[model samples]
Target: MGIVINQSIKNTIITYIGFAIGALNTLFMYVQFLGDTYYGLVGYILSAANIMMPLMAFGVHNTLVKFYNEFETEKQKSQFLTFILFLPFILIIPFSLIGYFGYHQIASLLSKKNFIVYDYVWQIPVIALCMGYFEIFYAWVKVHLQSVFGNFIKEVFLRILITISLLAVYYNFITPIQFVFALMGIYLTMTIIMKLYALRVKMPSFQLVIPKNVKAIIWYCIFIILSGSVANLLLEIDKFMLNFYIKIENIAYYSVAIFIATVIAVPSRAMHQITYPITAKLMSENKHDDLNNLYKKTSITLQIIGGLIFIGIILNIHELYKIMPADYSEGIFVVFVIGLSKYFDLILGNNNAIIFNSKYFSAVLILGLLLIGVTISLNIVFIPKFGIKGAAFATLISITLYSLSKLLFVVFKMKLYPFTIATLKSFALLIVTFVLFYFWDFGFNPVLNIVLKSILITAFYLGLSYYLKLSSDINYIINSVFKKIRN
Candidate 1:
């Protein structure tokens, strides 16, 4: 528990640093420097890269994490790592060539506007290749239980690069097209840096001897590819579908709101990086009781933290919109729907980690595929009607169903539920804190109002947590935090 708390605190700091950079880019630079259409194009390009990343990597990233423990020897681990590294190239190279040759036809089918998507089309493969290896190497580092550095590279370094790129765009040093290319360059460079860091830890050595479980590893990668695709689809499919149904400009607006809403999930994301490997290690040792306890604590802690972020955003959403251009302001509702989806995800705790690392992972993937089908169906039906808002609605519904399905599976199949009396108490505290902060009129100065209201809301939430005894974890965190401050 202390280790989790310590890592969580470190991750929180890194997340906030990333968030600050992200806030600057999204709220200030993006709005002021890029117009809606250009911004949306950037959004689409990134979303497309993310959508293709899993398939391009052939699930090697996840394969690394899942099978790292299976290799008992240094030579065995090296052989497996070597195979995973080269496997993605086999798929990505041909796909890139195909995309290059079929650029126009693909663009025609994807968009009505005769935009220069072709120039950027090849970047999809490049971004995918870079992002693919980044995840693989990141997982390699995680196997060593050194997640904070990887998280820093991912959450902090990437955003910092994007911020600099946005600044260049703001200064008119790069056109929109060039900016897109610059974004691709940033991803590629970041991947290189990540690789270097991983090498510093332990350079991956290629061994000629093949492991006996090669067939099993291949099957695991195949299953993981499908599972990873479904997961990415839940998050990125809406952006892709939005491109088909609406203009590129609308995507920019939707992306901003989604960004804000998704920030609530940062704690979950940060903790997951550290927790997944830990969970995997525990499961490998058949430590179900410890796993279950960790699951509950993570769920309650993340929900409490995520819920506060959700409420803070919801309460001050209007003020936030005022900072952005008028067109982007329409995405306020998208923020709410997506924020709720993230909150629900937090409440599910480490249900995903548990399922993904467990013996019944295939069953989990099958359920995920069903949910992806439902998500796609909902988006197709609703996107044309509601535009970006409808897309948000579809995402919210899909993620809600996805989280609930996982929770139920964990409870019924594994007989592991992540809820406790503390969960209920945390919910009550969240409600009371939100209601109190909701009624306060913070006046017209957006910056001051945001800061002042945030402080009060945080105080109320923590005060309520202390008073209600939400969890010993929370009480311990409070004491530790104060102790550190005092020291």
Candidate 2:
């Protein structure tokens, strides 16, 4: 718990700083510098690449984390690492061949609604390869329980580079198209840095000896391709599909709203950096009691923090929108719907880690596939009728159903639940705080109003949470901070 909190706090602070930079880019820089069309174009290309990343990596990223501790001898571990390292080429080689032979056809298919996407289609696979390898090496460090550097690279490095690229665009140093090209270089640079850092942490001996469980390793990688595909698809598919239905510029609007709502996820994202490997370790060791305790602690802690973020976003969403371009203001409903969905996901804590490492992962894969089908169907039906907001509804419905299925599977199959009496208290507090704060605001600039409202909300929520002792872990941290202050 000490290490988890320590790293989680570091990861959280780092992640929030990254989001702040990203928010500046997404909310202001991209729109002002690139215009709506190129902004949407960049969004679509990246979303498409993200959807392709898991398949490109061949699931080696996940497999490494799940099975790293299985081998006893250093020789065996080296063989294991060497094996997963080359595993991605199984798919990468074939994917590259298909791209070479069928580039125009692929581009034509993707650009059915928006012809601008045709030229950029080649960038998707190139960027996906970068993203895939980045995650692969990131998992490499995580198995070593050294995630803070990887977290920084993953969260902060790329955004900072993008900021530089955007500045270049503003000063006439590069065209928007060049900026997009520069993005490809940026991703490649980041991946190379991560690979270097991972090697420094633990260089594989490059032993070619295959582990005895080669069959299981291949099977898990195959399963992860499917599972990771569904998961990434669930998040990014809406943006990709939007390219097929609405105008490309609408994606820029949608992306802004989604970015604002995504801040609610920062805490979960930060905690998962460390908790995932820890959860995998616990499940591998068969420490059911510790795993359950960690699950509940993470759930309430994230709920407490994530709930505050959610309230703050919804309460200040109007003011936040006012600061954005008026054309993007229509996404207010999108923010609310997506914000609620992310908050729900945050409270699930390490549920994803539990499932992915458990025996029932295959079952959840089937459920996920079905839910993605439902998501696509809902998107098809809704987007034509309701526009961008329709995509939000589709996502909300699909994610809610998917999340509930995962929760129930864990409860019935593993006899573990993430909620407790503390969960209910946290929920009640979230509701009360939102009601009290939602209807009022300081009559200041949008930025100032957000700051003032956030302070009040943080003070009120954390003060009451401390009084109620909702989480001893959180209370202890509060006390520790106060003690340091007095000293």
Candidate 3:
């Protein structure tokens, strides 16, 4: 728990900082500098690439985390590393060939509603390839219990580079066309840097040898491609499908709202880096008691932290939107629905890590595929009537139902649950906080109001949470912080 808290805190800070930069790019810079058309173009390209990333990596990233511990002998470990590294080529080579041969048709299909997308469509697969390898190496370090550096690079580095590019565009130093080209270059550069860092962490001695669990490894990678694809689709397909029904610029509006809501996910994403591998290990060892304890603590802790963030976003959303461009104002509903959905997933706390690491991953993958179908159908029906908000609703519905399904499956199969009295107490506190704070206005500038209100909310929420001892782990950390400050 100490290690988990320590790393999670550090990663949370890093992630939020990155998101701060992203907010600048998404809200002010992109909206001001690039305008709606270019901003939406970037969002569309990236979302498309993200959807392609899992298939391009052929699940090497996930497979590395799941099965790395299975190797006993050093030679076998090297072989395992070597095997996972090259496994993606089986799909990558063919996919590249197909994309090359079928580029026009692919671009035309995606650009049906917006012709601007077709111009930058080729960048998607290129960026996806780089992102795929980056994650592959990222999982390499995670299995070595070293994730801080990778987390920094993943969360902070690229955003900083994008910030630079965005500023260049602002100053007219580069056109949006050059910025798009530079963006792909940025991804390739980041991947190269990540590959170097991963090698420094654990250099692989290249060997053309079969790993111990070659069959299981192959099967897991295949399953992960399916599962990872479904997961990424659920997350990014909203933006992609928006291209089909609405004007491209509406995606820019949707992107802003989504970015604001996505801040709630920082804690979960931070915690998962360490918890994922640990959860994998615990499940493999059949340490059910420790696993259950982790599940509940993480759930309560994330619920506590994630709950605060959700309230903060939902409460301050109006002020946040006021600070955005007038055209983006319609995203208020988008923020609320997506914010709640992300918060719901937050409280589930490593349920995904458990499922993906366990033998029952295949079943979850099937569920994910069905939900993707549901997501697509809902988007098709809803977007025409509701516009970008419709996409948010689709996401909200699919994500909630999908998360609940996974939670039930974990509880029924493992007989482990992630709820406690603390969980319910935390939920009640969240509701009360929302009811009290949502309507209160500081009567200051939007910036000042957000800062002031956030402070008041944070101090009040943390004070009550500590006083009531909602989570002993969290309470201990808060006390420790106070002691350090006092000293």
Which candidate's lDDT is highest?
Answer: 2
State the lDDT of candidate 2 residue by residue for 19-103, as single tens digits.
9999999999998999999999999999999999999899999899999999887778888988888889998999999999999
In candidate 1, stretches whose alpha carbon ends up further than 4 angstroms from where it belongs are none
- lDDT per residue as tens, model 1, 216-281: 777878887888888889999999888877788888899899999989999898888778888888
For candidate 2, the TM-score is 0.99
Model 1 collision count: 0
- The local lDDT score (0 to 100) that residue 8 gets in candidate 1 is 73
The lDDT per prediction is 0.84, 0.93, 0.90
Over 4 Å off, model 3: none
TM-score of each: 0.97, 0.99, 0.99
Off by over 4 Å in 2: none
Clashes of each: 0, 0, 0
Task: Tell me the lDDT of model 2 at 364.
Answer: 94
Candidate 3 weakest lDDT stretch, 10 residues: 204-213
Residue-level lDDT of model 3, residues 1-487, one tens digit each, is 8778888888888998899988888889999988899889999999999999988898989888888887777777778888888888998889888889999998899899999988788899899999999999999999888888888988899899999999899899999889989999999998999999999998878797877567888898889888888889989999999999999999999999889999999999999999999999999899999999999988988999988999988888888888877899999999999998999999999999999998888888888999999999999999999999889999999999899989999999879899988888898899889898877998889999999999999999988999989987789889899999999
